[model samples]
Target: MPPLSFSEGFAIAAGLVQLFVAVVFLRFRHGRPEWGLGWWAVTFAAAGVMNTGAPVLLAAMHSPFGTSLNVLTMVLGISTMGALVAGSRLYTGHPRPGPWWSFALTWLAYLSLMMTRQLWPGYESLIANGVTGLIFAYLGCLSLGAMRRESGAGHGIAAAMLCLYIPMVAGAYAMGLDQVELRYWSAVPFALAGLGVMSAMMGRMRAHLRDLNESLEQRVADRTHELRDIISSLESFNSMVSHDLRGPLGGMAGLSGVALSALDAGDTERARRLFQAVQAQSSNLSNLVADLMALARVSNVALLKQPVALSELVQESVQHLELSHGEGHAQPVQVAPLPVVACDKALLRQVLVNLLGNALKFSRKAARPQVRVWAEVREGGVQVAVQDNGVGFDATRQRDLFTPFKRLHEERDFEGTGLGLALVRRIVERHGGRVGAESQTGQGATFWFWLPATETPI
Candidate 1:
């Protein structure tokens, strides 16, 4: 109730400021959550509470509450020191000896002082103050040591801690000699030091986060380059295979056809069998050439992006497949209305053609062979699907299904070059899309791909 002294007023103001700062730190600290930061938060809050309660304790100098508050202040100060040490250790990724010993020592020293308070209260206060001061000094030294080791966030925090301790040491020295007037204003330096330490800690944390992001970006770039190299190699290999094998296959087919034609004019039954064998071999050779060409095209073709109507592409592919299959009385391919997508029209047409052709080829022996093409809009892209009631492959072997020359069925049952889906996958990926299939053994398969939608003109 009485008029407060200058020291009491200053202490109260400083305590409130410390409390405000601590609260502000807590509010923003959630943005960067780490073990080191948690320790720092505990330290700041404890220190703030101690400082804020100091004035009331000083005002009621002779009361039991004042005595209890003073003890609590010392306890909190010791806890804060330990927290700073632990926090520094955590930030630097260093392991520390057990913290229980330090806690035990602090409490033991505090209790000893309390036991001797009746006989030498002033001496006990000085000893307790000195002990706390030493703890802070030790923490600061440790921080300085960390700073010298490297240029990092930890180093910056260490330097800040060291700076904060300078004034604290000065205040402690002044307080030990009963110079209450000089030590009374020590809260200013203490607050400044706390602010410096916190700022450094925040700066270091931000730097570390930036470094982590940079490292991740570098790893991603490296992986991208690796993938590009693999794709380039695959393209070159396919081109070589297609170019080298085509000449020999063509020669063999031509020679066989000539030989069969010559034998037909001389002998009847023998000529017929020879001619059939030549036809089968020629068909196989043609399939091999087609597959090799498909593989080469998928690997090496450069895509030219343009607006393409999905329905038109599907119809074109269906027509091409029909011509290749010899205009049979097959069930007609049905294509639904689809949206326009941004892609290389030629490559996309090829992709659809191969998918549809595959569907038709595999479904040829079915009682009701049907192939359907459709498109659907999705988030960030559009999906095109070609579904067929074909002799589907095993889902478990789907990975191998896309590899060149990997055939599930025997050559006699299903005639294919086995590069169709592989080519489809390459073309879709080249257009910045993904291709996938869903099927079970005996059930039909759905081959689908997603392409980025054309952006609307402003």
Candidate 2:
């Protein structure tokens, strides 16, 4: 019912400010408990309760309950110091062991001492102020060191405010100041310390946002580069379609017309030969379309890897080539004991078929045509090679041998859409592998690819 004193009014205001800080820290903990904001919340809440309870309890100091409240407030104030130290350390990524239990033990000891306060008489105020001053100085030193090391404005502010409290605590204890003067000294610094903690949290959030923004910008730049590469590839694909597809289509149209004219002129033999040429062109067109589709599928389809014996795949590929050309007996392919590999079965099969087919087609004209399939196990992976004793290419001149629609020889000598090796490269790369070729003019050629020996689940 009485009017509030200056100290009481200031204590209430300080308590409100500290409670607000506690609520803010509590909300932060709710979102990210991993950051350990709960410690600071406890620190500020305890300080708020101590300050807010001081005014009423100070007036009833002579009573039994008042004495108990006084002791409880002193315990709360000491606990706030411990919690602040613990919270600051954890926030900076350095944590003390058993902070909670250590402080609990400290409170129990203080409580025991307070129970016998009648024996200490006038020294109680000196003891409490001295202990609080020592803790303040220690915290100030810690904050100062952290501020210098981390260049944090919050730490600097906290260090300055906490250090300010040490001098005021020392003066109050040395001069035997009244409870009102002591409360004023403690309340101002306590409010500033809360502000400093709030600043530290804001600084952390700013740093996090900066890191997130940088990550997003990096992703955007990488995506832009990938888009540019895709555009360039599409342009090359369009060019190849226009040039290569148009040639075969034009030839077929002309050949069909010429054969029809010969048939009308009653030249049956000439018409029959022309019709056969048209059929050949149509077959080549079909094969080209098939290779194009295979290339597209290799680029788009995800790899499904599994353990497979290279020997079985090699034999199957050879048999397929033999069925396609009917001259497999003349080529005489020798497949060595190939190592087992972990790869997409279908894609790997396509790679073997293309490599073996190339070897057979190129070497078919040799006097003693021979093809060999082999594998070598290296440190981290296995190397598979398809070698042939056919007319090899000049490796130095044919730099882009694996480029789509890039032909090393004339189409008349070797019938191909120039997409086979490109498809092989795409499939190998998709499996996290590498492809290479070794060749010399008039000698043999070896096309090799390397794949990881261990199976990596997709």
Candidate 3:
């Protein structure tokens, strides 16, 4: 065994360092969709073998079979080039590398060509340099294609910079036989530059991963906050239902017992009155249950949307309201022509029905029970409003008016379950719209909703 020279020793050290880098990359990560770094890891590892041994082997050693070192060097160069090409393609989102056998067959051919050179010594330099040049040219052209396509950051930078150095490396290696001392050392600079660019690319990937982690954390936080709010809302809803139902249930129970006792004592009139009270309580309970179900459906059910002409819809809703309230049909409805909007027809019909009903109910005492239905064009949508000359509520209590089982007027004054407006808001919002109302005490109230003008609903 012989000791190493200066350049050979430097090459050996660089090769070991390259191997260390390869090991680090292999340990880094393998879960990415783009596996360029994975291919790159293989690249540095193979390169480590060439750098560490190629210099000494070519300069001093000989195969027992008398094979020239040129054969091995050419094969290694092309193999390294093949890995680079595959990695770049993957990074650029080109077709992924083919089956392992495809690469294996390619490697076998390279090895076969190297062996062929040993058999044909006269044209050996031509075979080796020519083949190696083709490999570099293929790599250079691939980099150029990727550059034109504007591949990913890592691929783009490496291609853009390393491509410029490819010709010099190929030219230097092509003259390897003539310049024995310079050929191996000449390739070192370009290889080092390529490795540097790869490191930059890997650094970019690390930064991107950090950004992804931050984004994931933010989404988790947002979801946690939303979950907490939903839990609080459920608690409040439970409390409201329990408190509201208790009074009516107790009244119905007490009224039933009283009516039974009155019947037993032979008091027909008292029994009839007590039974009527029980019936009213039963009706209230039924309405509350119906409203609760409607709210639940509104939250859970998917919408079926269609383009609705508001003018015809308003008239139809008004007619439905009039028929439902035979006496309140006297409340004349004045409507303005409105735009076409995309919405869930069934839900929008219910919204109009509820708004019109409120208008008629609150204005029953007016000299002329008149409800005005109108609409206006607005940015991104159309806004339809239902206005009435009625006993409007206080502005401060407006927010509470839409709450489930919250009635602004007494049952003796105006009968309702109070889920009407709440249901309206939920349905409208689900359709990507908004509902609001404006009123002053004793003045007319105008309840309005904005429907987006969408060509298609998804």
Number of the predicted model whose lDDT against the real structure is largest = 2
Best by TM-score: 2
RMSD of 2: 6.1
lDDT of 1 by residue, 1-458 (tens): 67776775676676676666567556756665543666666766776665566655566666868678667666776677666666656554554553445445556665776777789655665565565556566666666775665454544554554455446656656655354543455565455545655555666667778999999999999999999998896797677567546754675677577667767677666666656776776777777777677666666767788888787777787777768776662355778778888899888888888888788888777788888888777768888898888889899988876676677888679766667777888888888889888998778888899988745321
**Tens-digit lDDT track of model 2 for 165-232:** 76886787679778666885588677887788688777877877888899999999999999999899
* 10 residues in a row with least lDDT, candidate 1: 94-103
Provide backbone clash counts, one per model: 0, 0, 0
Error of 1 at 82 (Å): 2.7
lDDT of 3 by residue, 415-450 (tens): 887789988898999988888889998897899988
lDDT of each: 0.69, 0.81, 0.72
Lowest lDDT block of 10, candidate 2:
97-106
| Two-way lDDT contest, 1 vs 3, winner | 3
Ranking by lDDT: 2, 3, 1
